[model samples]
Target chain A: MRIVVVAGGVGGARFVRGVREEVQRHRPGSTVDVIVNTGDDWWLAGLRIAPDFDSMLYTLSGQNDEERGWGRVGETERVSAELHAYGVAPEWFTLGDLDLGTHIARSAWQRAGATPSDVARRLQERWPLGVTLHPATDEEVDTHVQLAGDSAGEVRELHFQEWWTRYRAALPAARFVQHGIERAVPSPGVLDALLDCDTILIAPSNPVVSIGTVLAVPGMVEALTAEAAPIVGVSPIIGGSSVRGMAEACLSAIGVQTDAAAVARHYGLRRDGGLLDGWLVGLEDATAVDALESEGFAARAVPLWMRDLDTSAALAAEALDLALALRP
Target chain B: MRIVVVAGGVGGARFVRGVREEVQRHRPGSTVDVIVNTGDDWWLAGLRIAPDFDSMLYTLSGQNDEERGWGRVGETERVSAELHAYGVAPEWFTLGDLDLGTHIARSAWQRAGATPSDVARRLQERWPLGVTLHPATDEEVDTHVQLAGDSAGEVRELHFQEWWTRYRAALPAARFVQHGIERAVPSPGVLDALLDCDTILIAPSNPVVSIGTVLAVPGMVEALTAEAAPIVGVSPIIGGSSVRGMAEACLSAIGVQTDAAAVARHYGLRRDGGLLDGWLVGLEDATAVDALESEGFAARAVPLWMRDLDTSAALAAEALDLALALRP
Candidate 1:
């Protein structure tokens, strides 16, 4: 079986790890392609920092700090500290020393005129990672959050990182705008992977920014709904809260309640002009499954907390089973 | 009093330290402006690494590693090791963590349309570094060494770092080419500093690459000759050998023997359209002083080995005194 997962950074990284394990266990020869959100990618200190892409890369390569769930293991912030000493502000999000190696390499390749996808392929060549990673788009489509409470009449657009990391998403987001999304085409293999895969899984990432930004790429929605494969979306919002990250705040920005069923409804059935054939919610949110199923969707409840690799794999396996069962 | 010094990396840095100390002790309120060689600058992993400029910056700011004689006092190579793990080659010259911070800041400023001079000024503003640092040119003018023995029948050009660091200057250089030097204009304040200074001291740096590259700037030689202040050069070569760095090998590339008198003759008499009005040779090389004097240069013998700050200051005071005595 071939699987394609749409993913963000931390939570998506954990979810994809489970999916990779399930594929290795059940379909021994299957391939997995991850289409990662590049909306969080930005140029900081002349380095192209792709937070989501690096998180996936480090997690898959077994080099991610499991405790922090972000950045590389055995990382140092000497360079970051030095940058701070030089009075570079926005010091909230730190780039670790070991992580800088990847950014330095990627930035060099990107500045050399190679597309983001091309650089990703080159990076993946370093490790025997079981899955292929493709950026959502080669072009810059950064997610800018327009703050609702800006006293000035003019809108204040904050880079997704500033809003999410520095401010912890406390300031209400008036609107989430994926800058340059209209001009962004899906990276070379994104559309092909989504269409050709036997099953498509939307990892438990931010619905409004991660998956939403990916779908917003010009032809992405059309390609997903047109594909013959069944699409399963694992809810990031579970039991009236986010399992990881600030998905609750992101959902609130769009006037959606922090519940699995609400998120599933947000990504409605593909038959009803949306991108999901099935939805996977936490067992605690089991009641949400019945409500989703009533609206032409195949929904299921599972133990969604990825406490360990085994538990994560189990959740992924359940999601895959739902997709397979709903397949025409 | 205003002083201008032409400098390179390590040796130049040490000499500049002596000058700074001398100014602090004797002149009290004198200012020193350094026109540092940018020929050693190169792009590594997309970072703009300026070895000479950084060497001078660190030395004057009292942040230089006294034991290592280069880079920051406390530096970690975690990022560099990570880069090697990612298969980056030519890992000869390591960029330490703390050092990367400066490069990161400077590269960002340069990309944001600031000149190298502007970046230097901003960097100086962070530390109460009494001296001002200026690049020889704002534009790229990397020194490329043409190897004498390339099997391709054509001279192979290499970056100065590759020739100096990787090979340790073992390969006989057929010629030295300052790539992009022709189109290069002196960085802002370079010519003005040279022309307006009360004394112009040629630091004990490599004459061929360090001081030579500075003089190669289009109007630089004219400015130094036209300036009324006596241009005094302290010999990097003492007792028929280099005091520091690979001055002997660099001199051989330009067909000059490593001797105090020969170097003075190479710079020649300012009356005969050359740079120096006086030459400071080591006490061990006092025999060459008379020969230099015969060529119309006001030559003097001094204890040139900068063993400590006190000794370095004494040497700097002697050089300054020589310039003062030779002034018209």
Candidate 2:
């Protein structure tokens, strides 16, 4: 199966990591392609640090710090503190010592006139991925969250990490803006992977922000809509709450209800103008099954908890099966 | 007296750390000016890393790691592991976590088009050195050391750290090349600081590279010679041994003797016919005073063992006294 999986940082890397484990057990020909979000890239100190891309890289390599859900396991803060001594510090960020190296390499490559796509390819070359890994866009397209009033009056754009890590996403989110998406082209093979793939699985990632930002990039939504090949999305929000992060906060900001039916409805059905060929909700939200079917979209209810690799693989397999069944 | 120090990392930084303490004990208006060598500056992983300049800054700020002698205290190495995970490693050289922050800030400033001098100013703005700090040259001129035949082997120029840290300077040194020094201009205010100085100190830094690289800059030797201010140098070598690193390997490479007297004679009364009015040799090498004098340089013996801050200051003061006394 030529399966393309689009993912964000923590949750996305985790789900995709599980996908790799499942595929390893199957025949060697089932290739897994990962399209990671680059909306969380930031310049810390002098390094062009790509948080999401690195999280995905670490996850796939089995080097990720499980406790932090990001960064390397045995990370240290020596260099960060040394940077503080030089007085260029945003000391609150938990940038593991090991994490800085990826930023360093990526930044160096970019400075030397290499594109994000070029940098990503070199990194993936080491893994060969059994599948290919790709950044969603070559140019930076950060997803900034606008939060309700404090001193800035109505809203201010917060870097995704600021919204997620610093505020823990408790601050009322307004809407997520994928800044520079208009200028960003997909990382070389991204569009091809999505359009030419046998199946495209949008994992249980944030709908209004994470997945929404990926779809927001100028022509990306058009490409997915044009693809007759099955495109399946698993609801990140189970009943009405986010699996992680402030998806509910992001959903409310965009005026979309946070329930599974609302999520499938947000993607909408084929005839009514949306991207979902099929949608899957967790078994707890079996009621959304009827609503999705009535709206003329193929929908199913399954267990969505990523408690272990086996469970995540089952979720992926179910999503892939739906895509293969939808195949014309 | 307003004192200015010309330095690189390690030996030079250690000297200036002592100089900073000496200058503080003097009456008000007595300031120290530090001119750090930027030839060693490199853009690693996109951060503008000035190893020597920062060591001085941290030492002066009273936050240098006494154990490492470079980098900051309470530093961590989590970033290095992250770099390894990405397979983007020059693992041969260590980039402490806190140390990476300094590089990040400098890299950002430079990327935004700030010169090394400007970044240094920004770094020292909050620190109380009461002295002006400037990089010798704002250009990118890395020092490359060519070793004769060894494990890494022939015709290759090792980056300074690879030569120093990795090989431990064990290979026969062929020649030291300061790449790009010919095309460089002294950072703004550098020559002026040298020409307007009361006394010029050639800190007992590794002569073949560190301090030598600074002196090799096109107009630098001319500026020092043109100034009648006593050009006094403290010996980095005592007896036939180096105070640090492999000065002997370097001295042997140039066919120059490795004793205190030879180091004094190598810097001699000049670079291309210029010479110091005074040279300070360690007490253990008191016998070399006559030989240094035979080379047409007035030399003095002082206890150069920098066991503690006070002694280092005393040694610095003694050297300053000899320079002042040697004035015409």
Candidate 3:
């Protein structure tokens, strides 16, 4: 069986780890393809830093700092400190030494004209990461956020990282914009993964920006809608709050409420002009299941909190069960 | 008195430290300008690394690793090891973490369209270097060495660093070519430093590359010759050998013997269409003084071993005395 998972950084990485674990245990030989969001990629100090791709890569390679939930384990920030001291890079977005190793390697390849997908392939080749990772698109599709009420009382556009990392999503976000999404097409293998997979899982990543940005790539939405595979989305929101990250802030920016029912409706049923065939929410949000099912989704609520690999794998197994049950 | 010095790395840095100390003591409140050789500069991993310029900067700023005689005092090679693992950069040319900070800063400024001299000015402002530093030229004048034989027996051309660092100058070099020196012009303040200074000192650096490349700049030779200040050169060679570095290999490449008299003749006398008005050699080579004087150069021999700061300063003082005696 082939499983394709859409992922962002932290939440997505954790969820994908469970998916990989589930595939390894139950399916035994299933191939898992991960289409990672690259909208958060940015050039810092002339190095191309793909936060989502690297986060997933490090996590899968067992090199990620679990305590930090991002970056490499046992990493030092000596180089980043130097960069800050030189006043060349933002002090807030610090890159650890081990993390810089990845960026430096990727930037070297990029400068040599390798596409993002090509660079990702090279990186994965170095590790025994059983899963295949593909960027959502090879094109530069950076997410920018417009915020309201600066000191000037005027809207200002910031790189999504600045909004997310620096501001901690505190400033009222007017809207989110994928700067180059119009010209972006799914990276090579992305459409193939979606079309050929037995199941497609939208990870518990930020709905409006992470998964939303992946779907924003030209032809991606059409490919998913046309694919025969059942599309299952795990709700990032649970009990009127984000399971992780600032999904509420992102949801509110798009005038959507921070609830499982609202999020399931946001990605509605594929038969009703939306992306999901089934939706998974937290047990606490089980009350919203009937409303989602009434709207044509094979909706269910499970213990969605991924406290460990065992719990996360159980969540992945449930999502796969839902996808199979919804299959035509 | 405004003192100007032409320098490279290691030896030049040591010499310049003494020059700085000498200026502070004897010519209090006087300024020292350093015209550093950039021919040793190269692009490694897309960052501009000016070896000579950085050596002087690190040495003067008191950040240089005294034991290693290069790089930062407390340097780490984590990033470099990563680059090597990624097969992105030459493993032979290792860049330490703290040293990379300077390169990152300089590369950022260069990419932002700031000239090399402008970057140096900015760096000096951060530290009380007490001396101004300028690249000999802003142009990329990388020195390339042509070797007589390889396994293929065809003359192979290599970047000066490749020969100097990787091979430790073991290969028999046919000649040295400053790649872009033909069209190179002195950086801003270079000509002014030479023309306006009370005396010009040629630090005991490799003559054929460090000082040779500087003179190879289109009009640099003319500027020094026309300047009223006496041009005094301290010999890198002592007791029939180079005091440090691969000056012997470089001298042999240019068909000059490794001796004080032969080197003085290589630079020749100012009246005889060459660079120096006076030559300073070690006391061990005092016999060569009369020969240099007969060739129309005001020559003197003094203690040239830079055993300590005091010894180096005394040598600097002796070079200045020779230059003063040669004044018209």
Candidate 4:
């Protein structure tokens, strides 16, 4: 079986881990291809930092910090501290010394003319990740957020990282803009993964920036609608709140309600010329299933809290089951 | 009083510290400008690795590992280890985490169109390094060493760092070639420091790749000979051997004997259209003093071992006194 997953950073990494676990246990020999959003990537101290890609790499390789919920375990910030001392900007986003190895290697490879896909392949070679990670696009389409309510109509644009990591998403965002998105084509292998896969799953990542950015790629929507592969999405929102991260702020920026049914409607139904064939909402939001089904989605209420590996695996199984059921 | 010193890496850094100490104690309010060699610099993983400049910075700021004879005092190699694990080339040369900060900052600034001189000024701002440091040349003049004998005449050239750090200077070098020396001009303030100073002292650095590369800059020799600031050089060779590092290997590569008088002759006398007006040899090389004098250089033999700050300061004073006596 071949499966394609669209993902963001931390939440996406966790969800992918669950997907991998479920595939390994039940669907042996299944291949999982992850299409990671690169919208959060930015240049720091001249290094190319792909937060989502690194999260996927670290988490899948079992090198990720479980306690801190991000970055590599046993990581040191010596270099980051020194960068801060040197007065390098964006002091808020601190990269670990171990993690910097990834950025440095990636930057070096990129500088040597390797595309994002090439770098991803090289990075993945370092570990037996079991899944292939593809950058959503080779083009630089970093998400920049425009803050709301600027006096005198003055515009304030901040990189998604600055708005998210630095400000913790406290600042009200008017809109999220992925620079160069209009011209971005799906990275190498992305189209093949989507069209050739048996099922396509959207991980519970940020709807506004993560999965949204991937879908926003010029040819992505066309390719998705072109395929008969069952498209299933797990809700990042549960019981009117995000399962992880500040997806609420991101959704609110685009005026989407922080509710499972609303998020399902946001992705909409394939029959209605939108994305999902099936939508999995949390058990806490079981009441929204009828409304979602009424709106033409193959909606199901399941235990969505991925607190540990088993739980994540179970949630992933539920999503896969829903995808299979929705399959024509 | 304004003084200029031409220097290299570790040896030069130590010598400059002494010069700074001596000037502070004896000639209060005096300014010392150091023209640092950039020949040893190379791009590592896209970061500009300026060994000599960093040595001066770390040493002057008291952050250098004195016992290990290089890098930051409490350095970690997490990033470097990662780089190695990632299979980045030149695994022999490892940069410490704290040290990488400087390189990253420098690479960023250079990428943003800041020259070496501008970066130097900004780096100096971090620490109260009393002496002002200037790169020998604004242009890239990385020294490449050609191995003495290549089988089948397949000429092999390695970057100076690879030769010095990786091979430990054991690979017999045929000649040292500065890649862009032909068109290279001194970096900003290098000529001014040479021409406008009251005295000029050549640090007991590597004569071939360090001080030699500085002199190799197109207008450097002209500026040195054009000035009457009494150019005095302290010999890096003592007792028919180099005081530190592998200066003997370098000197032999260029067909210069590893002897104090030979090195003095190599620099030649300012009267004979060479650089030095005065030459300071170690007390062990006292026998060469008379020959040096006969060769048109005012020669002196003094205790030259910089074992401690006091001894280094004393040596600096001796070099200063020699320069002043040779003044026109």
Q: Write the per-residue lDDT of candidate 4 for residues A1-328, one digit (tens) a residue.
A: 8889999989999999999999999999999999999999999889999999999999999999999999999999988888888887567897899999999999999999999999999998888799999999999999999999659687799999999999999999999898778899999779878766788899999898999988899988778778888999999998889988899899999999998888888987888789989999999999988988887888899998999999999999998898888777
Q: Over the stretch B1-328, how does candidate 3's per-residue lDDT look in tens digits? A: 8889998888999999998888888979888899999889998877789999999989999999999889889999988887787777798997998888788788878888989988888778777698889999989889999997756657789999999999999999998998757789998789878766788999999998999998889999888788888999999999999999978899988899999889888987888788899889899999988888887888898999998899999999998888787777
Residue pairs with colliding backbones in model 1 are none
Stretches > 4 Å off in candidate 4: B151-153
In model 1, the Cα lDDT at residue B121 comes to 85
Instruction: Pick the lDDT winner.
Output: 4
Sort candidate 3 into its docking category: medium
Tell me which residue pairs clash in candidate 3: none
RMSD of 4: 1.2
TM-score of decoy 4: 0.98
TM-score of each: 0.98, 0.87, 0.97, 0.98
Q: In candidate 2 chain A, what residue range of length 10 has the lowest lDDT sum?
A: A82-91
- Model 3 ranges with Cα > 4 A deviation: A150-153, B150-153
Candidate 2 lDDT over A1-328, as tens digits, reads 7788877878887788677777787635787878777777776666677777787877877778888677888776666665666655565677666666777778777878988889988887665555577878887777788777777565777787778778878888877777767897666688777666688888788876667777777777676667767888888987778888778777888899889889888887766677788988999999879878887889999998888889987887788789989998
In model 4, what is the error at residue B92, expressed in angstroms? 1.0
Backbone clashes per model, in order? 0, 33, 0, 0
- Report lDDT (CA) for all predictions: 0.87, 0.77, 0.88, 0.91
Stretches of model 1 off by over 4 angstroms after superposition: A149-153, B150-153
The DockQ score of candidate 1 comes to 0.75
Interface RMSD of each: 1.3, 2.9, 1.3, 0.6
Best by DockQ: 4
Query: Between 1 and 4, whose lDDT is larger?
Result: 4
